[model samples]
Target: MSSLGRHHDPIVAIATAPGRGAVGIVRASGKQLQPLVDALIGAPLKPRQAHYGPFRDATGQPIDHGLALFFPAPNSYTGEAVLELQAHGGPVVLQLLLARCLEAGAGIGLRLAEPGEFTERAFLNDKLDLAQAEAVADLIDASTEAAARSASRSLGGAFSAEVEQLAERIVNLRMLVEATLDFPEEEIDFLEKADARGKLAAIRAAVDAVTARARQGALLREGLRVVLAGQPNVGKSSLLNALAGAELAIVTPIAGTTRDRVSETIQIEGVPLHITDTAGLRDDAEAGDEVERIGMARSWESIHSADAIVFLHDLTRLADADYQAADARIAQRLATADPARLLQVFNKADTGVSAGSDGRLLISARTGAGLEALRQALLKRAGWQAAPEGVFIARSRHVQALKQTAEHLAGAAAHASQADQALDLFAEELRLAHLALQSITGRFSADDLLGEIFSRFCIGK
Candidate 1:
């Protein structure tokens, strides 16, 4: 399926990190790197060979001396000719070398690489599939070892291979059903056979397996967004520091100390946790109007937008008027909030609060009390498994697609129950659903989607 004239022209860019380092790399790919090679190193280069050379300007003066590597067509990153020049990482040196390549290849039309343009080219050239291309970004953005491993599985096509297998099974069953289309007489017996239902059941089971693992992968990759909210100085900051095991938040006896949202990512038993501590709710007459207003706004946001809320309560001060008022306010927030992803926690149990209700937990962040219960609560919320051996990362788009596909399948089943068994029509519906599942794995790709995805990746990925 390779296009014959799909050379994207030569693109040159700095692959290494910006700013000074030991050395910086300048890379070029396309049909013609000869001009750049000849001008930069003063000679045409052999494929995959590293040659010592001096990069020159248009007038043939030395710009910088360094090692040059050349990869010829159909074997490079973009499936075309590639050239690399490594020079000192100084900003001045890289600029000089890049200017040289542009001038040398100007006649052949060289363009600057956009952010992730190189990887997008790789995807277009069939060097990587859609899922693998996305995995490139996931791998870069992975925070924990588990996320990295899941992303690696995605890149290796473990996820896509599962989808393809399921798609093939669905197609085969459709083929069996379609086999009776030519001979109307044998259709009833063929459709009534026990084997037909069994095959459909097996396909359903496979879909279920793939979906469950994809869900696990998604939870791992995206992590849980846990927001802490309570009256001022109820140990919200202390809990963040305890869970994070570091002073990520400034803790003091002074209430409303944390004026801004402080966030930290910590792993609790292989599950990545995104914890946010916001300004606590309180009634302060002398408080800055903007600060109170902003804090109240953020409290509402965290309550509704968070994946889960750890509603901290100071056990010692629960009877206090201001603290009681804060609790009532939370009840009001919940009534008006998103009505999903909420949890309640009573902190400072070491000060003598016995135990929490069935759905709540009491903890002392200072003494590490109730931390295990807290961690387990989060793990349960995230649907985290101990071992994500076969997990494959999924986006919200993937989740929504799978859901739609399931809906289509449900409709097909209902149609069949109503005795409308023009299974060719049913099969086509299944096919659409199957295609949606395939989109998760890159089986049916759109050019624009690929563009958007790889454009978010860092260059040289």
Candidate 2:
């Protein structure tokens, strides 16, 4: 449904998950909620106070004993008068309370809230900006402790504050440039007097720093995609089980035991890493059956799309001629993959074989050796730095906006250094940069983008 037309109508919904709980809340937000409050409780509720009472239906029959809270307009979450009913945590009980609210509020056009309508209203009412509003959902959906903390910081306006500061600086420069353009007859070199070049340089540096931190935040939220691949029976499943600390995949001495990908998400230092163990890689001619060939085909596909690959090799089979030939062929094929994202690891290190220092990792999945190093290596590959304490949760779109701002700043710098001193071009570039920053805080956002962003949120929030 469109958020433009029906935002002013009174809305009510159960504010808790759809299940039995110790207590459930039926929340309503709109202007002039006093009538609805009186109809349900038979008395006017004091603003911002909770009163113990019984909710009643239209016929004055008690629905349930609960706490009623009333918040006057401009003092509530959605910047409107609000009412909350706390009742026993039963699905049927909550439904009854909700129906009662709708029935009693029918005169004021009260209706069920759409998904994310409440938070969208909060955003529209200036109770929260776009970034902070997004953090509300991020906090709820965070998969790691560090992620939750970072999202909390964002919700508290840490990220938005920084973006606003950057925007303010850009605005100051734009004003200086435009002022110089307006009064060219005043024989004064505005660029030299105001030190516009130095200020632009400083702003560029600040934008770069924010971009770096935002990339880290994005990494924490979306994690790296790692794929483990090797010949059959090369301890791929064992490594997966070890990383997840569970027997997620069947491990045996038989080849082609896994006919599909076994995926798991494991966190190292609060950074999530999604690891997928694919079927072993081998030639179709050596396949025992069509099923194995299909699995092997899938393995190659996983390897091609992976963000990182851990190529495991059996330590004991290094001397076997047939195994070496297959390994060489796989290595040749992997030559096309990204060298920065690939790691060659030798498994079964407990067999007492001397591991050479050829930049390959040696580990035994059984003994858990070198796994910590591997984890660190993956984090390094993903360019994760700084603890989550100093980082605020950010999405890929935020990163893209920051990058666009930087590019515009670069264009501004180029225009500033020209022989003719193209102040008009410089001012235009700064204006573009300012707009890029404004999008992050919803200052210049499109209505469709707002709809899309809020659509992902759960109902009643």
Best candidate according to lDDT: 2
Residue-by-residue lDDT tens digits, candidate 1, 413-444: 55445432566666676777788877876668
TM-score of each: 0.90, 0.95
Candidate lDDT scores, in order, read 0.76, 0.90
Off by over 4 Å in 1: 1-7, 283-288, 336-340, 356-360, 418-420
lDDT of candidate 2 at residue 456, scale 0 to 100: 89
Q: Candidate 2 on 203-288: residue-level lDDT in tens?
A: 99999999999998888788889999989999999999999999999999998899889999999888889999999888888788
lDDT for position 325 in model 2: 94
Worst 10 residues of 2 by lDDT: 415-424
Question: What would you estimate as the lDDT of candidate 2?
Answer: 0.90
The residue pairs found clashing in candidate 2 are: none
